[model samples]
Target: MLEFDIWELYRMMLRSRLFENAVMKLWEEGKITGEMHLGTGEEAIVAGVVSQLIDGDAIAVTHRGTPQFIMRGIDPVLLLLEFFGHPKGLCKGQGGHMHLFSKEHLIAASGIVGSSGPAATGFALALSYKKQNNIAVAFFGEGAINQGMMLESMNLASVWNLPVLFVCCDNNWAVTTTTNKSIGGTLIDRAKGFGIEGCSVNGTDVEAVWELANEALSKIRNNGGPQFIHATCTHLEGHLLGDLLLRHNRDPVLMAETADSLKQYAGESLNEVLMLLRKIGGQTKKKGDPIVFIKKKLKDDADRLKLIEEEVTKQIDQVVNNALEISKGGMKND
Candidate 1:
């Protein structure tokens, strides 16, 4: 039996989506600088995995890590302040969103593609040395599997019997190129070659991810050594916020500009680009929206759902407002 609270998972997913939406607004208004990578699409995978984590457990995530950090109980206000480069931010205005580090939470993230594997493995090594019954998790994209460091980390984790769960959030696209075109063979087979047990799951379903992650964590806790989870998710917002391809699909002017650029330099036709964009856009449909999927399942308790959404919205609004005030020097910092 799947023993978990659907409402709690729904609330977590909703809060992550709303929080990222607020961050998107900030980036749009030019308040938050730099290329922001919103985890707008991978909410289910993040919530499912992070919610199952206990204290003393560690995590290392990829560049699109806001969802995981927030779900892991980091203060959203501090995260926003960091994005704004405020001195009171998480890394004291130094790390921004990509290079977030929270020793208190035992979580660290890097913009580097495959660095999470090594970081999480190191955390697992430390846990082993200290004789703690906790584990470490590394979250990365399918593209990172090709990186030598990532493969080596997996091998090392297996060799030394480290309690680390390597999660491959395969979105089928590595930035712009299709991941299947680059990655050879199945990821599960790759893990098996390294003596690690694993499973694959549809990351869009929160309950599915939750159940599988719970089972994997249970095994790791029982000294099952290193485990792997190849969860396939959709990167609905392309690679980053204000993605050029998605922008072209939305704005006619950008579309024309892209067409002209392609014709002038690459000699590619606009028809080809449109066809590709259409295919990508089709994937971001009703079936892929994890938030709506879970919300539908919880429809029996509509009143409770409404209250949860309202609470999350109000909380996120206050967080954004306070973070903005602090960023604008209108409020005191902690």
Candidate 2:
């Protein structure tokens, strides 16, 4: 049985959605620098896997990993400061969005592709040498599965029997290009080729991912070895904030088709997601979102859902306003 706090998971997932929406808004108002890459539709996968991690367990996440950071216990306000390049950020604003590290949580997010694979392997190897039971996790995208560094890391981890878990967030596309156009084999099969155990889970279903992750992590914690997870997910938006080149330079029909494809890639219910996307895009369409799905699945009452929403929204508003205030004042993140 998986030990998880369903209520807490849903609350954090709601926070993730709200925070991402705020970041996008800041970008549009020219309040933020650099391109914004969001994992708007992949909340379930990140929350599911991260919420189950223990205190000593560590993970190396990708650039689109704010949700993972939050679930792993990073302060959203500090993350906002980091994105604002403030001296008060987790890395004193030097890391920006691509590099976020909270040693307290034993979690780090990198800007480099496929870097997490080797990073987590190294961590696990150190744990093995120390005779510690702590496990390491590498959170990468399906696109990086083909990277030589990733393969080499997998081979070394398996050979050394390091306690590590490789999580492949299969969002189907590497930026603007589809993964199907690139990846040659199923990710689990590749893990098998490296003599590693692996499985695929429904990314849209948080319970499913949590169940599989619990099993895999427990096995690694007790037996000491590497594992892999090919979690199907949805990225929901463009490659980058100024992705107009890909969407506009191409046929409008192609762009619409791509958006429609993501509709099928994520949750079964788009009524809520489309509604939130419209709101984020400044449209006044009355629609629901993924949090509703979680509430319904968990049998949470309307009162409980309202409480969660109000609490998360309150926190989000505070962080967004504080970030903007800090930016306006030219204050450092400190």
Candidate 3:
């Protein structure tokens, strides 16, 4: 069982990696149109932070939100289809890499810069008004710190004591502009200016992010107001899809450095998880044909996908039924 959890974490990382590669390939092949931001190295932040969220919690994400959407239970196939602009996509082929909406999960991912902050604050405000203990998370980049809307949202969240967590994904660079050149002050300081608690975490370390976010979520659940966390992660790839080739900008050195860092962190975590799994007698299947391993994993994913689809359908049906019942009643004079 412990091995399962570790493997699951690794699997989620692999899925995000694969999904990113697929999207980049599509962009190169001219299949994916418009601007695309690929989150190749920042998978841990999304996976780790999202693991702390409950079923009914809401999430607001920035342009590089594919991993968050997947972590929130979006199917890889559906995500791929969405990238391909298929009719059966998450946004019905309307939203591409930057925009992803999953009503069932209460997620509203945006392409606009710093847009998620206010949306997250709004969700938190609604939850507070309804007396719900649900927490809302806003995932934005360091570049978003310069946007006025982010500050405004932070002020609103602090003033209202909303259950919102602002996650600043400090990937060092915001697009082509470096954070040092763009951001005037420290990210944590910005949170402090709003009278919110803040922490700086190693975004490459999934375990660290998970621990910190878990603690913050617990505080929010207990009505602790707003918190901000700066995840100092690395950007292993270009800002947008195909920009690497288009701009003739190569960062092989940075890519290798970031990969080494993540690998070191993952290795330590994997070893711990493996030890726990060994105590439970859970081990990976014996070496076999590569094709067989691929087939087995694919089959398992297919089954899980079916289950997720069924659950989403059921939720949609419930919403429809509720709406229909409300419509059936005659309009009462206010």
What are the lDDT scores of the predictions, listed in order?
0.89, 0.78, 0.71
Model 1: residues with Cα > 4 Å off, grouped in runs? 1-3, 260-272, 330-334
Worst 10 residues of 3 by lDDT: 282-291
Q: 197-244 in candidate 3: lDDT tens per residue?
A: 999987766666767887887788899999998997655555675554
Off by over 4 Å in 2: 245-292, 295-300, 332-334
Clashes of 3: 0
The whole-model C-alpha lDDT of candidate 1 against the native structure comes to 0.89
Which 10 successive residues of model 2 have the least lDDT summed? 279-288
Model 3 per-residue lDDT at 23: 67
Quote the positional error of residue 232 for candidate 2 in Å.
0.5
Comparison by TM-score, 1 against 2, better one: 1
Better of 2 and 3 by lDDT: 2
Candidate 3 residue spans exceeding 4 A from truth = 1-6, 245-334
* Highest-lDDT candidate: 1
lDDT of 3: 0.71
Q: On residues 1-334, what C-alpha lDDT tens digit does candidate 2 reach at each position?
A: 1378777778878889899889888888876789778767678888887887776888898888888887777888888888888877778989988888988888888878999999999888877788777889999998788789999999999999889999998866676456767988778899999999999987777778788988998889887589999887665555566565333334456656656876765665555444333333421111223454576786747788788889889989998887667767776433
